[model samples]
Target: MNTPEPLASTVVIKTVNLGRTLMDTEQQPLTILQGINLQINAGDSVAILGSSGAGKSTLLGLLAGLDQASTGEIYLNQQPLTQLNEEQRAQVRQKVGFVFQSFQLLGHLTALDNVMLPLELAGAKDYRKKAQNWLERVGLGHRIKHYPNQLSGGEQQRVAIARAFAGEPVVLFADEPTGNLDQKTGQTIIDLLFKLNRDQGTTLVLVTHDLELAQRCQQRYLLQDQQLILQTPAAVNPVNAEATP
Candidate 1:
């Protein structure tokens, strides 16, 4: 696969022939994905849908600059991520945000403190003020003082979501963000995601198995048998597509 030509418009992220492989215990390389070409326009919301073990998480990690791809190049704001070392990668991280299915919040921190964690680390002086503002926006103002264990699963998820967005990231990536919550709560979080997209024009890349959620995104990609499958706009809801051999 070759690099897809990035649009004339400014894109927040661009991948050139992206691919990834992992090493198994037997010392053999397990090919997780190959020939992935993607372009994310500024403020575009992209949803990645696939079956279990389809490398959704792996793809997200690679895109977030947390993991390196075996081959290919990743550009965040036109900066090549593969060219940068780990410490350099950390610098680029300030422009991106991520939320996981497990709500990887600090177990000991309160909701307010958890949301402030990222901002504080980035050297924001008004971390507390900004964190509280986001908490109130996420409808978790009352739960501010409560620890992770003290809040309900839904509340914890919301806190995680707030934390991810609190820093006001330019690009946001979420992996099964609503996986732990109930249906109603999941829907609420989904709404929050779209709301953030509309209000802030944040570039969003979401990975999920939920058809409805995928449909809501501006663009969608489906992975099957380790290949990139282009999707039509309305095809976000589980449409049949041929898997690459």
Candidate 2:
């Protein structure tokens, strides 16, 4: 599959000396991330790899404006997130989408409803049509009426992906998106993710422990010991090249 070239040099996400800390059981401050500085260009795919408990998800949450940092600042679409209060941060997140490992779907809502909920909340027009279109794009159209419990893990994830892209977000943050699936299922999900990234030009910031999945991205970083380390040069998609005939 062909990857889309970045639309411009626009920086969709940037971090400056970003750090996060939490109080431990005994009241000692435990630093999870520190001194992290990075810039993600529009239409780029970035992977953050780390062992479990290395704060990869924490960093993702901060970058997505779902959580505030203990120090430093995060800018999403040129808006400073660290300086914004919760409500203000939510306004900034209107342009953002998220996919999680646990599928994060409401048990009672059908797949279509799950995808439509956010759009409805945001007051988007023709939200039902948009939701249906996205579900079809993710190959879940036939399962639109199925609840999360009725679908397999991969199917549930496909619904989640549909929900994420339906909003037409500028950036998509995925946390261990394929963590619950078997290897084969995970590969299918990864392929779907890249295909959407290529087609829609959504900047992808993924957090995962899977190095193979990380290699599929344009840039890869390893989060370790409270720091982010660059693991590869940007704009290199070895997996895509190898997939070419």
Candidate 3:
């Protein structure tokens, strides 16, 4: 008989009835997300598709421990986020990586230094070599010395990706990673992202308006009306169902 893996080992992130809300000056409650539940297995690629202001990024932020939810539970690698303090959550976040729509690269740092930042922060030795290797893998070896403004949008995104991967996080969350690029460039970035995700076996949870990109993931989620729903019929083209907002 084969031994089975622990639940924690198989599931990278899980949530139950997760929700977030805010209050206006009048203390009027504004609900953003409610009854949001999700599960992402190790090495799985999942995408959450929604129009603008549908709370996709908000949900991602909550799951990533970047923002606290108003209610419900979130488990990251079997650790309960609701129970962890802000400082503790920050520690947890160190084990995860993120790629944002803006690329989020520091303008003053060269591509190499940008990639090296996380590794250095983690006190990892030989960060320079590791960062260089990741940059080369992303086809930016020759451009490692280039600053963010000196590089094209695609090149800058590649540098951001390299930085995200350098830390070897257990999971990666990406929000509108290709939103700023042209279609052709977006496709290239998508290919690179999925390839790296596959090669590294990193769990991927992405939020995007791009139907084609979302379809590439193993599972699909649609955020609507402050709720998260699984894509039905399994073969429906998301783009045909809703316009990218």
- lDDT per residue (tens digit) for residues 59-172 in model 2: 999999989899987889878787778899889999999999999999999999999999999999999999999999999889999999999999999999999998899999
Best by TM-score: 3
Give the number of colliding residue pairs in candidate 3: 0
Task: After the best TM-score superposition of candidate 3, give how far the Cα of residue 47 lies from its true spot, in angstroms.
Answer: 0.7
Instruction: List ranges where model 1 is wrong by over 4 Å.
Output: 1-9, 234-245
The lowest-lDDT stretch of 10 consecutive residues in candidate 2 is 236-245
- Candidate 1 clash pair list: none
Error of 3 at 118 (Å): 1.8
Q: What's the distance in Å from true for residue 106, model 1?
A: 1.1
Worst 10 residues of 3 by lDDT: 1-10
Error of 2 at 86 (Å): 1.8
User: How do the residues 1-245 of candidate 3 rate in per-residue lDDT, one tens digit apiece?
Assistant: 34323456699898989999989789999999999888899999999887789888889999999999899889887678888899999889988999999999999999999999889989989999999999999999999999999999999999999999899988999999999999999999999999999999999999988878888888988788998888854644754546644
After superposition on all C-alphas, the RMSD of every candidate to the true structure, in Å, is: 3.3, 7.0, 4.0
TM-scores for all candidates?
0.92, 0.91, 0.94
Point out the worst 10-residue segment of candidate 1 by lDDT.
Answer: 236-245
Kindly list the per-residue Cα lDDT of model 1 for residues 17-129, writing each as its tens digit: 89999889998999998988888888999988887889988999999999998998898866789988999998898888888889998898999999998899899989999
